[model samples]
Target chain A: MKVLVAVKRVIDYNVKIRVKADQSDVDLTNVKMAMNPFCEIAIEEAVRLKEKGIATEVVAVSIGPKAAQEQLRTALALGADCAIHIETDERAESLAVAKLLAKVVEEEQPGLVILGKQAIDTDNNQTGQMLAALTNLPQGTFASEVVVDGDKVNVTREIDGGLQTIALTLPAIVTADLRLNEPRYAKLPDIMKAKKKPLDVKTPADYGVEIASKVSLLKVESPAERKGGIKVASVDELIDKLKNEAKVL
Target chain B: MSILALADLHEGQLAGATARVVAAAQAIGGDIDVLVVGEGVHAAAEAAAKLDGVSKVRVADNAVYAHQLAEPMGALLVELADGYTHVLASASTTGKNVLPRLAALKDVSQLSDVIAVESADTFKRPIYAGNAIATVKSDEALKVITVRTTGFDAVSDGNSAPIEVVDTVVENNQSSFVKEELAKSDRPELGGAKMVISGGRGMGNGDNFKLLDGIADKLGAAIGASRAAVDAGFVPNDMQVGQTGKIVAPDLYIAVGISGAIQHLAGMKDSKVIVAINKDEEAPIFQVADYGLVGDLFEILPELESKL
Candidate 1:
């Protein structure tokens, strides 16, 4: 079985994102960019499958600006065979991204597709499931654990109440959750090797997919800051405030 | 314009989040219709009919929808996509799993986890873990949306809408229901609870969670954990409250030893009142907290338990 892992480049998780002064969008002028945390987990899962001899190959794919190739290279360093970059300047929404990936799925002919549950930049947990819908494949989302049997994949999903397990046929889509597996950092040698790996760059138009955003962004602004109130000096005072002042107790 | 709100039905009862979604749909200003899709979901349909602003309830009772599985549910929504100007659902795991599929099937974008309905075509949602709010307008004629129910107040029961059985259940043989291991708790659910008490890495171990049990039981508060605590294997993942975890809003939220990472604050900052108890006085949690107490959790928690 072959696995295709979709990765994305987003603002590093540790960075505090700032909205531009004009409120057009987040300030990305000199911000640090890294592979999306969940996508790294997905790549790690696929590579682990390959290491275990359950998968024959793992291909990394990304859809973003030209700079997104950095994320693809990172994926390659993490043990993906090669990289595919769908170059686009437009911030394509989940619908368009899924369509492009669906076309790529047809070209790749992989038995399993793995993607992050959501991207940190847009916070849209849609693309993987959307790809599954477009290709009429079963999706196991928010997967914390995945095991491949003879022709079926057993996935443990992290849901609201607890975990839910589902089994899908070989050709399925699985979205990685945080607890899936901690991604391994690429060694210096692997990073150097990834620099020389084969990378194919294509435009969305190459797949006959239009890169039009369906949602129009009107504005972006910082969330309202909560003003801190004076703290009580003692537990008695805290209880008094809770009982009399806030009346929440 | 007409809004079709998908009822979040688990088993046979209408989820409380469905009422909140209906309220969000009402805010969008439209004739609202509730779609209840499940097996033996007449009770859910009846409950949806009683929602304050619903005009009609459509029930598509089928075995394929028994577990809110995505495959058949997404196909059914796509088949019924016509004739509705807007399709809304609660931003639950089920809705998150299905709405995007429907949007893709229609070749349109989905506005997800919407915190406010700005206009018929515009919505305000949290991006980058609620640090920033983005106002977005969808050009798609048929808008597919999912609202974070915590952002909207649930509607009260006051209407008697007509229940119409919908026979437009699309069938798919892609996946089937598997076993679920839900946490059986006697306390109120975290999302619906009036009060919440959450711990973080400072709790040390799973055994230390007992320090909160006495207080939680006394106050009828739901127990939660910061992502660090969950990552430390001190609690189940479901108890996690953060950006990638469960978003919760209650009347009162107490943070015990929770330093409050940006992601964790995004989930609980919407609570009416927040109290942070951390030994680090400079912890960022205190910045947004209405009340802050600086002390060792082991001493403070025991003291709090004794006093309360």
Candidate 2:
């Protein structure tokens, strides 16, 4: 079986983000960028499947600007055998991204597709399921554990209340949740080998999917600031404040 | 334009998030029709009919809808989606589970977890765990979306509308309903809680999470954990509140011992009031906090409990 993993490049998880002056977008200039952390887990799950012989090949694909090649290379170093780069500078919505990925799945015909439940950047958490929907394939979303037996894939999803185990057919899409697995760091030797990994570049139009956006962004203002409250000296004082000042109780 | 809003029901009652999704539909400037699907959900459908701006409430009651397995629910939504330009649900487990399948069945893509509707086709969503925001436009004739309830207020109940009971035939036996392991907690549901108290890796061990119990109990707050705490196996995956986890907007959110990562903040930054208690004065959580208490959580939490 073959597995396809989708990765995305985004602002580093450590950096503080600022809204642009126009309140229309994030200030990406000079920001530290890295592979989305959850995508790394997706790639890790795909690579681990390959290691366990559940998958014969693992291909990593990314949809972003040319700088996204760095993330694709990161996935390759982590064990994806080859990489596909769909070059686009525009910020694609989850639906458009899923449409593009669905086309790629049609062309590649991978048995299993893995994606992060949500990118650290957008946190939309829609693309993988959307891709699954577009392809008419079964989906195992927010997977904490995955077990493949013959033609069935048992996926343990991390739900808000608790855990749910769903069995899906092969040729399924699975979105990796946190705690699925810790991604491995690429060893120095693998980094050198990743340079030789085959990386294919394509355009959104190449897949016959229009990248036209439908949503209009009116503004991108900073989230409201929290007002600091005084630390009450005692529980009784806090209660008094809650009942009198805050009136939340 | 007409929009379809799936009213989420749990135990024959309307889920509060359903009202929030209806509010989002109102923002899109369209006539709203709500679908209440569950077993014996007539009461819930009637409740939905009372919400302001809801023109109609379509009820799909069946045993299959009780568990809300995505396969049948998606089919039902797709069937009801005819002639509607937009379909929306709350970004809850049920909504997330069913909407994408509906989108795919309709051959359209779904916009997931939209924080705000920019236009009929455009949306503002947090990307990269709220570290960055992306504005996306969908061109599909029928757009499917999941609204972040935190970004919108729940629909009020004043206007009364007619409740339309629509029967659905659930096809597709390819998928079977499996057993679920829902975490039993007395605490309020995390997504809807007004106050949240979250522990972090600094809590030391799974047992140490008990330290947060008294504070949470006093505040009637939902208990949450950082990804680090979840990673350390100190708590269940559902307790995780971060970019990749559950995004919440509570009136007051308190972080205990959490060295805030950007991923962790994205999920909770929309909170109205943020309080951070950490031993390290330089913890990044303080940057976003409305109230910062620089001290060890072990010491501070007890004091906080007693003070409350």
Most accurate candidate by DockQ: 1
Question: Residues A1-249, candidate 1, lDDT per residue (tens digit)?
Answer: 889999999999999989999999999999999999999999999999999999999999999999999999999999999999999989888888899999999999999999999999999999999999999999999999998888888889998889989888779999999999999999999999999999999999899999888689999999988888767677778878888988998
Quote the true-contact fraction of every model: 0.79, 0.48
* Runs in model 2 lying further than 4 Å from the true structure: A227-244, B39-43, B50-52, B63-66, B104-111, B116-128, B131-141, B157-161
TM-score of 2: 0.90
The worst-scoring run of ten residues by lDDT in candidate 2 chain B lies at B170-179
Q: What are the interface RMSDs of all the models?
A: 1.1, 3.2
B1-308, model 2: which lDDT tens digit per residue?
Answer: 89999987654688888888988998898899999887888899888988999998899888777667666787788788999999999888778877877876676767778888767888877654565566777778998888888999987889788887787777655455566788888888898899999999999999999998998898899999998998888998889897767889898888888998877887898887677778887788888876677766777777778777
Candidate 1 retains true contacts at a fraction of 0.79
Residue pairs with backbone overlap in model 1? none
- Clash totals, every prediction: 0, 20
